[model samples]
Target chain A: MKKQIITEGKIYFPLSETLKLVIENIMKRLTRALLTMSGIVLSIAFYTTLMLTASALKYTLGAQQVISEYYWWMLFLAFLVSATGITNSVLMAVAERVREIGTLKCLGAMDKHILEMFILENAFIGAIGGVVGFIVGIIAAIVLNASTIGISSFFAIPGIEFLKALLSSILISTVLSVVMSSYPAYRAAKLQPAEALRSVA
Target chain B: MGGEASYAYTVEVEGLKKYYKMGNTIVKALDGINMKIYRGEYLSIMGPSGSGKTTLFNMIGGLDRPTAGKVFIDEVDIAQLDAYELAWLRARKIGYIFQTFNLIPVMTAYENVVLPMIFAGVEAEERRRRALELLDRVGLLKFKDHKPYELSGGQQQRVAIARALANNPAIVLADEPTGNLDLETGMEIIKLLKELNEEREVTIITATHDIKMLAVSDRIAWLRDGKIQRIEKRSEVRFKVYKVEG
Candidate 1:
């Protein structure tokens, strides 16, 4: 048999297929996915609650100052903790799937594909967490400020400001998730197929 | 020598060596191994643990780089290819079956079979059609939607075999494929592999301790201490069955 000459072969995994895979994986591991998202959800909820509460107070009382420097520092620390949590969760997930990674590599998945899958999965988790946190934060803000600012003041809070806060929180959560998970994703991509297959994970 | 050109070799390894550094000492996993595997042949590498059977299997599959020497697949030196080209070679030419049946846990049997085709850029319609066809071929079409964990050991291995044949690869490398199954199931898997090899004319190479494989293999390479001790044609080999006296 004469051998065919080598030529560049195309690797085509459509974005839709990748997204479907990511969603299926997240759904199948719903417990772990929820656990991993908890940190981001709490942190973003705290952030949105603080921001919305400060805005409502300023709008109702005409106060020159609302949010304190201490609260800002607290928010920063919360974000740092959540980011670390995301990294730890993703790394553990990668470790648990070492054999799967090896099999994917054997099936012709490039490093870029693995990295893309991880990032996309985490990013989707972050987005969902962000939205859920925002809703929780809104409700909490309204209840916490009702006695001081009254229910009427809650309605008076500018809609644009609320929208901005919601969007920012989502952006922060998504960006944080991607940035934190990048290292774990890179490690996964760099795994040697032979060694990974040998590992009992 | 005059008829050398008549023989089509799918894989050739020359002076292959793999070494690992353990503390201050060196472990020679594979030392100066050379071999040729013909097209459409059923070959088995028989050896005990730490005898470098898996190491050699990995080398041939392009899953590992040798410390020295070269591996030629279809007359092209694999060492000369870049990572992209190597991935292409693995995707287009070689299929792998593991002892553990490493199908993606999240995917169903059908999806598992379709994955390699997706990576190879096959169209969606074609992927679905071929995936169904291959699963039917492995007698797993009814269980297409079942996940790996839901299947029995033999059934899962069957799914894996379907996945391996998805891309129509020229060679299928099975590493201890029957190591985890019961005697009956192991024999069935071996027989399935033999039938596929004959039907598709795909070169089948397996590394295993299963003596049952000898009945199907055209050639057997016996490895010991990181070297091939001998190569024997199926007809040239014999086995002695002994009964234990209580």
Candidate 2:
């Protein structure tokens, strides 16, 4: 009455399910999204604040040290916060998935499979949140620039430097998310299915 | 047993012991328990609170390492496998149904059922097919796009059952599956489980305080204070099963 067990083929193969589950988590993350993303918001705000301060200094004092300050430094700080936010969200999600993780383990999911699921989900989260955040960041920067420098500042939209900046931000966010989330992903993967199910909040 | 044409049992739990530390005190959840469940067995593990039904289930599922003893499934000792090996085994070999339903509140019913197969790396077309099939099997295909909040408790548990069987594991270990449901809904769940066992030959191990489940079980292992106080045969031993009114 039942199918025979022959497990030579992949049981935990389609990476999309994990991605799908994570995306669902990300969507549900909205209520607490602000809280989860506080680190990101603060980092972005800090970098922008510093940039505004430096720009003010450059205009008023025209110091050589101010001239030497690169915009990349500001972007780096923003990227760090963004990466940390993604990593934090991912780790928290894994921690919440204790029973589900245990269920997966009990159902014969491999550790690598579980690990792959979390990493894939986190990476997807990074992609969705990072890209959206990058777009939002760029828009904010442009709007501020426009208000400060007048309509002429709108020309910066199609500039080659603008495209490059966007690309770099996305790249940085992706790298930051992946690198930061690896350890937590590994922890989720190494969890024992049976023991994990017994865990209570 | 090498080159043998048959597996010894669906599950072989032998002298398995597990201890938990509650602050400074070590609580023995299971103290050297042993069991053998053959293929197609409709068994209920009945126990009072603090009994080791869950712990025993955990060890067999490879979610916990025992303080002592071995658990074999399809001739493989689950306790012997390392973490990665055990994970792989679980993904392919077991179907677990929990009393809590436990579906992610945000995802649709389709997504919930597909979680197991998705983890198993089934291809896109096949995964979709299987998810749909499973949803239909649980009579939730029409509710595929709906989230968990939209469903009733019984519906959610049905979805959980579908998810558990997603990988089509040899055994289904259900813990208090009807504990949260009303009498009518609980009876419905029990009927559905019975159908699954009969039609699929999926060995069912239900842990519950539900008297109906014990009444209809092939065997009922009554547990008290972390020990199997009595094991009774309801009808034909080890899965011949007792008939009950639908």
Q: Identify the leading candidate in terms of lDDT.
A: 1
Which ten-residue region of model 1 chain B has the weakest summed lDDT?
A: B237-246
Model 2 regions more than 4 Å off: A1-7, A32-89, A120-158, A199-201, B1-8, B121-134, B235-246
Q: Per-residue lDDT for B1-246 in model 1, tens only?
A: 122335599899999999999999999999989999999999999988888989999999999999998999878789887777777777778999999999999999999999999988888899999999999988989999999999999999999999999888889999999999999999999999999999999999999878888999999998888899899999997665552110
What is the TM-score of each predicted model, taking all chains together? 0.95, 0.80
Number of clashes in every candidate structure? 0, 23
CAPRI-wise, candidate 2 is: acceptable
Chain A vs. true chain A, TM-score per model, equals: 0.93, 0.70
TM-score of 1: 0.95
A104-157 in candidate 2: lDDT tens per residue?
Answer: 666556777677766665555445454565556555655665565543434423
Which stretches in model 1 have alpha-carbon errors above 4 Å? Answer: A1-9, B1-7, B240-246
lDDT of 1 by residue, A128-182 (tens): 9899889888988888878877778777789998999999989999999999999
CA lDDT of B116 in candidate 2?
70
Q: Compared with the true structure, what per-residue lDDT tens digits does model 2 show for residues B1-246?
A: 123225647787788888888999999899878788877888888876678888876677666678988887777666556655555566666777887777766778888787677656667788789889888987988999998899999999999999888876778889889989999999999999998988888889998877779655888887766777768788643433363212
